[model samples]
Target: MNAAEVVKSLLVQRFGIPSAHLNAETPLRSLRLDSLALEELRVLLEEQLDIDLEEVSLTPRNTVGQLVAAVDGVAA
Candidate 1:
Protein backbone atom coordinates (compact mmCIF):
# COMPACT_ATOMS: atom_id res chain seq x y z
CA MET A 1 0.00 0.00 0.00
CA ASN A 2 0.89 3.70 -0.27
CA ALA A 3 1.06 6.55 2.22
CA ALA A 4 -2.64 7.25 2.09
CA GLU A 5 -3.45 3.61 2.60
CA VAL A 6 -1.15 3.42 5.54
CA VAL A 7 -2.71 6.51 7.09
CA LYS A 8 -6.26 5.39 6.44
CA SER A 9 -5.69 1.94 7.85
CA LEU A 10 -4.04 3.31 10.96
CA LEU A 11 -6.91 5.73 11.55
CA VAL A 12 -9.57 3.12 10.99
CA GLN A 13 -7.98 0.34 12.98
CA ARG A 14 -6.62 2.36 15.84
CA PHE A 15 -9.16 5.17 16.03
CA GLY A 16 -12.30 3.40 14.86
CA ILE A 17 -12.76 5.87 12.04
CA PRO A 18 -15.34 5.17 9.36
CA SER A 19 -13.81 4.37 6.00
CA ALA A 20 -16.61 6.00 4.05
CA HIS A 21 -15.67 9.55 5.07
CA LEU A 22 -11.95 9.17 4.96
CA ASN A 23 -10.76 11.40 2.14
CA ALA A 24 -7.49 13.08 1.32
CA GLU A 25 -8.80 16.36 2.70
CA THR A 26 -10.35 14.97 5.84
CA PRO A 27 -9.42 16.96 8.91
CA LEU A 28 -7.70 15.10 11.74
CA ARG A 29 -9.89 16.81 14.31
CA SER A 30 -13.04 15.70 12.55
CA LEU A 31 -11.84 12.16 13.09
CA ARG A 32 -11.31 12.86 16.78
CA LEU A 33 -7.58 12.17 16.68
CA ASP A 34 -6.09 13.74 19.76
CA SER A 35 -2.49 14.63 20.64
CA LEU A 36 -1.92 11.12 21.95
CA ALA A 37 -3.19 9.68 18.72
CA LEU A 38 -0.84 11.93 16.79
CA GLU A 39 2.07 10.76 18.92
CA GLU A 40 1.09 7.16 18.35
CA LEU A 41 0.80 7.78 14.64
CA ARG A 42 4.20 9.42 14.70
CA VAL A 43 5.68 6.37 16.34
CA LEU A 44 3.96 4.07 13.88
CA LEU A 45 5.28 6.06 10.93
CA GLU A 46 8.75 6.07 12.41
CA GLU A 47 8.73 2.29 12.65
CA GLN A 48 6.82 1.53 9.45
CA LEU A 49 7.99 4.27 7.11
CA ASP A 50 11.14 5.39 8.87
CA ILE A 51 9.80 8.93 9.00
CA ASP A 52 10.52 11.21 11.92
CA LEU A 53 7.93 13.34 13.69
CA GLU A 54 10.29 15.94 15.05
CA GLU A 55 9.00 18.47 12.56
CA VAL A 56 5.65 17.08 11.59
CA SER A 57 2.99 17.96 14.11
CA LEU A 58 -0.23 16.13 13.39
CA THR A 59 -2.87 18.39 14.85
CA PRO A 60 -6.58 18.80 14.24
CA ARG A 61 -5.82 21.72 11.95
CA ASN A 62 -3.67 19.58 9.74
CA THR A 63 -5.19 18.29 6.52
CA VAL A 64 -4.72 14.83 5.06
CA GLY A 65 -2.72 16.33 2.23
CA GLN A 66 -0.50 18.01 4.79
CA LEU A 67 0.02 14.73 6.59
CA VAL A 68 0.90 13.00 3.35
CA ALA A 69 3.23 15.80 2.44
CA ALA A 70 4.87 15.70 5.84
CA VAL A 71 5.45 11.98 5.54
CA ASP A 72 6.74 12.37 2.03
CA GLY A 73 9.03 15.14 3.14
CA VAL A 74 10.40 13.14 6.05
CA ALA A 75 10.79 9.99 3.99
CA ALA A 76 12.70 11.91 1.39
Candidate 2:
Protein backbone atom coordinates (compact mmCIF):
# COMPACT_ATOMS: atom_id res chain seq x y z
CA MET A 1 0.00 0.00 0.00
CA ASN A 2 1.06 3.55 -0.63
CA ALA A 3 1.26 6.18 2.10
CA ALA A 4 -2.41 7.14 1.90
CA GLU A 5 -3.55 3.55 1.89
CA VAL A 6 -1.22 2.62 4.71
CA VAL A 7 -2.38 5.60 6.73
CA LYS A 8 -6.06 4.86 6.24
CA SER A 9 -5.45 1.21 7.03
CA LEU A 10 -3.69 2.02 10.28
CA LEU A 11 -6.41 4.44 11.30
CA VAL A 12 -9.12 1.93 10.59
CA GLN A 13 -7.45 -1.15 12.07
CA ARG A 14 -5.43 0.18 14.97
CA PHE A 15 -7.46 3.22 15.89
CA GLY A 16 -10.83 1.58 15.41
CA ILE A 17 -11.92 4.25 12.98
CA PRO A 18 -14.75 3.52 10.65
CA SER A 19 -13.47 3.52 7.10
CA ALA A 20 -16.64 5.10 5.79
CA HIS A 21 -16.04 8.19 7.87
CA LEU A 22 -12.58 8.84 6.49
CA ASN A 23 -11.88 11.42 3.83
CA ALA A 24 -9.14 13.79 2.82
CA GLU A 25 -10.80 16.82 4.33
CA THR A 26 -11.57 15.15 7.67
CA PRO A 27 -9.57 16.59 10.54
CA LEU A 28 -7.79 14.35 13.03
CA ARG A 29 -9.79 15.78 15.88
CA SER A 30 -12.99 14.91 14.05
CA LEU A 31 -11.80 11.36 14.21
CA ARG A 32 -11.27 11.79 17.95
CA LEU A 33 -7.49 11.43 17.76
CA ASP A 34 -6.11 12.96 20.89
CA SER A 35 -2.48 14.02 21.39
CA LEU A 36 -1.47 10.62 22.73
CA ALA A 37 -3.16 8.85 19.85
CA LEU A 38 -1.46 11.19 17.43
CA GLU A 39 1.91 10.24 18.88
CA GLU A 40 1.08 6.57 18.65
CA LEU A 41 -0.03 7.09 15.06
CA ARG A 42 3.24 8.80 14.31
CA VAL A 43 5.13 5.79 15.59
CA LEU A 44 2.94 3.39 13.67
CA LEU A 45 3.26 5.38 10.45
CA GLU A 46 7.01 5.61 10.79
CA GLU A 47 7.23 1.86 11.34
CA GLN A 48 4.86 0.85 8.56
CA LEU A 49 6.08 3.41 6.05
CA ASP A 50 9.71 3.17 7.16
CA ILE A 51 10.11 6.90 7.06
CA ASP A 52 11.01 9.43 9.73
CA LEU A 53 8.33 11.92 10.73
CA GLU A 54 10.52 14.01 13.02
CA GLU A 55 10.33 17.06 10.78
CA VAL A 56 6.61 16.87 10.26
CA SER A 57 4.50 19.01 12.53
CA LEU A 58 1.43 17.07 13.46
CA THR A 59 -1.58 18.43 15.28
CA PRO A 60 -5.10 17.20 15.80
CA ARG A 61 -6.28 20.11 13.69
CA ASN A 62 -4.48 18.77 10.65
CA THR A 63 -6.54 17.07 7.99
CA VAL A 64 -6.14 13.50 6.84
CA GLY A 65 -4.95 14.89 3.51
CA GLN A 66 -2.37 16.97 5.33
CA LEU A 67 -1.05 13.97 7.20
CA VAL A 68 -0.84 11.97 3.98
CA ALA A 69 0.99 14.79 2.28
CA ALA A 70 3.47 14.98 5.13
CA VAL A 71 4.14 11.26 4.94
CA ASP A 72 4.45 11.47 1.17
CA GLY A 73 6.91 14.29 1.62
CA VAL A 74 9.11 12.22 3.90
CA ALA A 75 8.71 9.13 1.78
CA ALA A 76 9.65 11.05 -1.32
Candidate 3:
Protein backbone atom coordinates (compact mmCIF):
# COMPACT_ATOMS: atom_id res chain seq x y z
CA MET A 1 0.00 0.00 0.00
CA ASN A 2 1.00 3.59 -0.53
CA ALA A 3 1.61 6.17 2.17
CA ALA A 4 -2.00 7.32 2.30
CA GLU A 5 -3.32 3.79 2.52
CA VAL A 6 -0.73 2.90 5.12
CA VAL A 7 -1.71 5.87 7.24
CA LYS A 8 -5.44 5.19 6.95
CA SER A 9 -5.03 1.52 7.74
CA LEU A 10 -2.84 2.22 10.74
CA LEU A 11 -5.34 4.73 12.11
CA VAL A 12 -8.11 2.18 11.75
CA GLN A 13 -6.41 -1.00 12.94
CA ARG A 14 -3.95 0.31 15.49
CA PHE A 15 -5.97 3.24 16.78
CA GLY A 16 -9.40 1.65 16.59
CA ILE A 17 -10.80 4.39 14.36
CA PRO A 18 -13.64 3.52 12.09
CA SER A 19 -12.50 3.25 8.48
CA ALA A 20 -15.54 5.08 7.21
CA HIS A 21 -14.85 7.96 9.55
CA LEU A 22 -11.47 8.67 8.02
CA ASN A 23 -10.95 11.27 5.36
CA ALA A 24 -8.31 13.69 4.23
CA GLU A 25 -9.87 16.56 6.12
CA THR A 26 -10.22 14.69 9.40
CA PRO A 27 -8.19 16.28 12.13
CA LEU A 28 -5.88 14.16 14.26
CA ARG A 29 -7.22 15.86 17.36
CA SER A 30 -10.72 14.84 16.34
CA LEU A 31 -9.58 11.27 16.71
CA ARG A 32 -8.55 12.05 20.29
CA LEU A 33 -4.89 11.33 19.61
CA ASP A 34 -2.60 12.86 22.12
CA SER A 35 1.08 13.63 21.67
CA LEU A 36 2.05 10.19 22.94
CA ALA A 37 -0.28 8.55 20.50
CA LEU A 38 1.12 10.63 17.69
CA GLU A 39 4.60 9.55 18.68
CA GLU A 40 3.60 5.93 18.54
CA LEU A 41 2.06 6.60 15.16
CA ARG A 42 5.35 8.05 14.02
CA VAL A 43 7.18 4.92 15.01
CA LEU A 44 4.64 2.73 13.27
CA LEU A 45 4.80 4.91 10.16
CA GLU A 46 8.56 4.67 10.13
CA GLU A 47 8.41 0.91 10.34
CA GLN A 48 5.72 0.56 7.71
CA LEU A 49 6.92 3.20 5.26
CA ASP A 50 10.61 2.68 5.97
CA ILE A 51 11.14 6.41 6.22
CA ASP A 52 12.32 8.89 8.82
CA LEU A 53 9.87 11.51 10.12
CA GLU A 54 12.17 13.20 12.59
CA GLU A 55 12.10 16.32 10.45
CA VAL A 56 8.37 16.22 10.05
CA SER A 57 6.42 18.06 12.66
CA LEU A 58 3.48 16.13 14.06
CA THR A 59 0.66 17.73 16.00
CA PRO A 60 -2.82 16.69 16.98
CA ARG A 61 -4.04 19.76 15.10
CA ASN A 62 -2.69 18.43 11.87
CA THR A 63 -5.20 16.89 9.51
CA VAL A 64 -5.02 13.38 8.11
CA GLY A 65 -4.14 14.88 4.72
CA GLN A 66 -1.18 16.57 6.32
CA LEU A 67 -0.05 13.31 7.83
CA VAL A 68 -0.32 11.55 4.52
CA ALA A 69 1.65 14.30 2.80
CA ALA A 70 4.33 14.15 5.44
CA VAL A 71 4.69 10.42 5.06
CA ASP A 72 4.60 10.62 1.30
CA GLY A 73 7.17 13.38 1.39
CA VAL A 74 9.65 11.25 3.27
CA ALA A 75 8.75 7.98 1.57
CA ALA A 76 9.34 9.54 -1.81
TM-score of candidate 1 relative to the true fold: 0.86
In order, candidate lDDTs are 0.80, 0.95, 0.94
Candidate 3 wrongly placed segments (more than 4 Å): none
Q: How close is candidate 3 to the true structure, as a TM-score?
A: 0.97
3-73 in candidate 1: lDDT tens per residue?
77788788788778889978878888888878888888888877877667787767888977788788888
Best candidate, TM-score: 2
TM-score of each: 0.86, 0.97, 0.97
Give the per-residue lDDT of model 3 (tens digit) for 38-75. Answer: 99999999998788999999999999999999998888
In candidate 3, the residue pairs with backbone N, CA or C atoms under 3 Å apart (3 or more residues apart, or in different chains) clash, namely: none
**Range of the 10 consecutive residues with the lowest summed lDDT in candidate 2:** 48-57
What is the lDDT for 22 in model 2? 93
lDDT leaderboard ranking: 2, 3, 1
| Tens digits of lDDT, candidate 2, 1-76 | 9999999999999999999989999999999999899999999999998899988999999999999999999999
Better of 2 and 3 by TM-score: 2
Error of 2 at 60 (Å): 0.6
Whole-model alpha-carbon lDDT for candidate 2: 0.95
- Give the count of colliding residue pairs in each prediction: 0, 0, 0
Of models 1 and 2, which has the larger TM-score? 2
lDDT of 1: 0.80
